[model samples]
Target: MTWGKVREIRDGRCGKGRAGDGKESGGGRRGRGVETGQSLTLQSLTQWKVPDLGSGEGSQEGERVKSGGICAERAIAKHRAQRTPISSKNSSDCPRTPRHSLNMGIFRFRLMLLCLIGSLSHLNSSVADEAEDISHKDADEAEDISHKDVHCGVPVNISHGHYEYLSHHDDDTYLSVIKYACDGPVYHLEDPEEAVYICTEHNKWKNAKLKYKLPECHKVSCGVPKDIEHGHFEYVTTHGVTSYLSAIKYTCDANYHERDFSDEGVYVCTIEGKWRNTDLDFEIPTCEPVLCGRPVVHLETHQRVVGGQMVVNGASPWSMLLRGADGEIIDGALIAHQWMLTSAHALQGEGRSEAEIKANFHAYVGIEDAREMDSAHEVHIDKIFTHPKTKDAMVYSNDLALVKLKENITYSNHIMPICLPAHDLAAPGKVGHLAGWGMGVELKPATHLLYVELGMANASQCLHQLAQKQPGLFTEDAPDLFCTQRSALEENVCRGDRGAPFVVEEGGVEYAAGILSYDEACRAYTYAVYTNIYNHLDWLKEIMANH
Candidate 1:
């Protein structure tokens, strides 16, 4: 039977009872000899027969039906041959009816339809799953782009002094430049101070090791020491640069001598950038006058040679002439073998340079006459330890200064050091002796060393006189100062006698009690101000010990 006819017959038969009868309801057709409710097999479907159309039962329509039924039977037989037969206890029990055959054919067609529907559903589900995977992949790509935008190609911040930044082409690598500050020119094991720094991908600047091989930039300097007045210094390492790890040494000029101190006179730059002593116990080096031993004494009378009447030669062996490039500037006392006591004003040149100051002054020791320097010892000034307060005020309030000689003065008969007083022993009415190569009664320079006897003046009397003479200059008598007045006419120290010592005899030994600081122009009744040396004894001892 044709496929369309078989479908139409199967539908018509299914509308009837579910029995396996081959009976046609219309025209009262006779039932086929097949039992109702019987199971059909592949053999039954194949053996089903089509009625002959030439028997004239239904004429032309019957012929058409018979032809379709014949084709349907042939198709069923072919399908049966390809399918496995169902095994049963009685194979012959299966019916050979066309109705059963039609029902079997319809059952096979429905199974195939269900299978096709399932396959189509599975294919659609697979397409949807593939689309979801693609969407997730796109999202991941976008996330990666966002991450790259955040971290890459961003600038770093660096704000240290003398430091600069340099960038590299590779994003993971960077470089920075460092500049020299106060501590460097040479850094890191004698390496030329390079300010360059490198940063790797893993080695960030936060983890970088910065080694400060040199001293810190701030605290590094060997400034001019007040004690080193007459000598010159130079850096042994780098000139004009006093950075860390540098060295400097000092030397005295011709005829000048350095004190025999423990220090080797060399200073090394420390990590703090300051010049420090190798031993750490001392400070800068010191120089002093060369010693010459005791002077000659008269054997018979136990007295030295006398000349110039009261101004006798060698009467005041501790007296010294402080000479400048021009002439005698002031007088000083040899208080110690290496130290000289002077007035602060004697060294004052407020606007002068260091070179000018050094070129101007020198110490002339053991001289009976200022003009005769042949037999005298010329000692160069090493360092001048001036009072810090005096230097600030630019005045003579604390007008005492100690001069360190280039070499220690040898104890000579004419160049012996005088003793300092034990206390502020200035008593009013006590007589003190002052000597210097100053203007005499005639206001002219003396031919020889001049001497005078002056009486110590009380504070009240001295203050009254000073206030009357120069108002606002000597407002009050400072504790470190004392005044002296000539006991007789023509016995007065004049303008050139500044820095001379006022000596008092105690136990037959002269002790320096004051430093001659200032005096009015020589007058009939003259009084002079002197810095009380006793008050500054502690400062003197301390400076002497360290320097």
Candidate 2:
């Protein structure tokens, strides 16, 4: 028979027997129901067909039963084979009633449900932990992206200046320290406070506080004052936190006098971010003109003659000797009380220190005889100013220089200053007088004090002769050079004539028209070249006034 039909019949029989037993067996049946329910629940679990463990309806315990379904069925079949029929079974041998079977079934179903609930609980806990780990990873990745967007790329660039950048890990902002680049010119901020700029995560720059604006490289300038005439400014040094403090000194040129007679005229940068004199409202000094007179002797008395005649005693009073360490090197003119003019080549040498060159020179004034110095006034050389463009073996262009004396010389009838020519004195066939200790005939020793009258040579004829003798030496007619030929065939200037003045009388005043620069070998009909002092009058005056 079917198990359902047999269970119905068993229930009917238990109901009849329970009615016959009455109230006295009530407690005993209830106690036995619990014990039998437990025992039968265990057997039912082993024999029943397990449901398919699908979806949320089943658990790991149910899955085990489903996997062993065939084994469970075999166990149930064996149990049935050993069971006795209900019709012949004694009531005492099988005391479990339908009520106990019902209780056992309920207990088994409840136990399975509890097992399913526990499996679901464990699955949910695993899912929650995995989700938490993924969420944390996403957060870290987002933070990295944010950091890269904020501070990973290049910082903003500045022109004519530079900046320093600093970043912090916890902060989302970057700091920019701005500063000017040190180059052509330097500048400083008026305020002493520091300026800072902030760059935010959004890639925007903001100035925290700007007390003063930074100067552009092109705008930075040092305006030298122009209040003084015939003077110039010179840089000494610049110092300050922002390079705003500038030290400057002033000077005057040759044949000019400073107001205070001091060489040091220094100025410093003011706190107002301006360059000014240390003594504000101080009088702006000027370079005053120096008065000079003609020599005491007549020009006709110092005329040149054949065989290079010796000059009369004290006739060329302005003529002075440039004495080096060994002896006389060249001739110089007394242009002022403390200034002498000569050739730059006479005082300049290659690879020589300025001190060494200055130490080598001493001026001897009022001397007619080169061999005798007892009557000469010896003056120490303070400084030597050479022409800016004077170069050795370069055709003697701009061959000029000035000598400053340690002390002013006392003027006397035997010593005086000659006048500087105000206009061009170079003309064809014009005669000029030259005085120096140049070599005489037959390469003999130089005349004690020699004089020569030279006639100005034709420009074309001079250039032709120079090109024929020394090709490529005479390039073109220079503004500061003139050619002259001796009045007689054997009366030309020689080697020692360099730096001597070529004087020309104008209205009773002897003005220096030229200076002996270079000459061809001592031959008949050869021409000598002289530096045109008239063309450089302004330049000479300027140098004297500013130096």
Candidate 3:
């Protein structure tokens, strides 16, 4: 018997023992009735063959094999071995129930087989229904996953950088968002508020820019520098790029300088994207107009005398040296961009004519030692204006003159003009400096320049002192020149010192108080006659205005 049939018997679907499945069969025979050649089904079972175990023919079949289903396979094997006609090739020819087996009744056996087949068919139907339901469930889950993938587009990408999601999400739904960022120093968000984007209607992202344009990742930058009032700036590193790590240097224009001494005017890009000077913490440096009369140097504070110690470089920036066509050098003072003050007699020195003086008249400055004049920037003289009341070269009254230069000067620390005095009267007892050209009185000219300090004397003292030399030149009431006397009664202010500026410092600014006009040939001691500079302010202003 097949395992299926055996299971049916084990389920108690055999003989008269079953009630709900079908009617009784072989009421007391203690055996199952089944059809050997018919396929089982729930609706049909009339072709069963029942054996007569009461007769010797049935007894010889399986009494020794045991009738209980506990040895069902062994009993079936022995019973099939006992088939008649030596078990013919066709199962129908194997055996047949004799007419005596009709005692068990064909109706009863058919009832048993029908009930067993019906139970088996119901079990198979339930399993197929459950399997179909599972298949449909799996297909729905797969469709949900595929639909999510097709709901939205790709992620956003920015120039110079990438991005990431602000928060995890199951799908790119309407309201999903991403936050944008950039590599430090090298790149940054142009608008940080726009760094985040939200998925809006139509499955598109939106930010402060409104459109779905990827937020820009621009190179970090400090914009073009602030414009200085009298200066400008230039790049020190890669040109045309104001991005991260850029460098720049600021410079003042001609005749201008940075007001703050601490600021070096060199700047660099910072990590936070600001331009800053390495040594200073202030904002952009400013360029102010050069303050006149202030020397761009530090000097020794000791007192100076007549023909005293040598002056430091940059200490007397306004002091000038003039050379004529005859190669004669004298001292002069730069008082403005194109105007200089000097002694009128120095203009006509060496007996040269006015035309000869203007032919190759050049001014040299910025050097104390003449040998170091590697760049002798020769500024040509455009014109000369001698005082209207000035006498001959041998006279001392009205001895001051003005020289106009052909080109305008761009002032610097080494070549700046001195400030003019505010009042026109020579202040009595005020001390002043007189720079000396080392053309020694009886000796050859020296390369280095020297300076001396002198005190202005009262008009009576000045006039009394001058009367001893040029006796008839002036009186106390209306002296033609003022006197400056050295405290130390040492060497005299002589010929080579002609045209030197008597510079006085007031309120930290140097001003031309007088011009050397009548320093005798080393004969007069401790005192020199200078053409009054303050008294000639009106004439100086008028000449400069007309020019």
Which has the greatest TM-score? 3
- Give the alpha carbon lDDT tens digit for every residue of 1-547 in model 1: 4656434333333224522255564354332333443323333344544333334434454444444544556645655887754333223233334555555655675565456435545755787899999998999888655544332223243322243335543343333232333224333222224343444332343222344232223334545432474556777887876766677776544323344332345777775446776653236544454332222221121112221123443567778887777775678888777888887766664654445656788777877675665435788778777765575324547787788888777653356777878767788888777778777666777667767777898866886777777775565757777888765444567777888898887665677888887755367446788888888888889999999
- Rank order (by lDDT, best first): 3, 2, 1
Instruction: List TM-score per model, in order.
Output: 0.43, 0.44, 0.49
Model 2, 268-384: lDDT tens digits are 555444555544433454655434544434545444456666766355778888766776467888887888898776556454556886677666887778666553478778877
Assess candidate 3 and give its lDDT.
0.68
Deviating ranges (above 4 Å) for candidate 2:
1-293, 301-305, 349-353, 374-376, 471-473
Each candidate's number of clashing pairs is: 32, 10, 0
Tell me how far candidate 2 lies from the true structure as C-alpha RMSD in angstroms: 23.7
Candidate 3, superposed: residue stretches over 4 Å from native: 1-251, 258-286, 298-301, 304-307, 325-327, 372-376, 440-444, 471-480, 489-492, 521-524
lDDT of candidates 1 onward, in order: 0.60, 0.61, 0.68
Candidates arranged by TM-score, highest first: 3, 2, 1
TM-score of the candidate numbered 2?
A: 0.44
> Which residue ranges in model 1 land beyond 4 Å of their true spot?
1-310, 349-355, 391-394
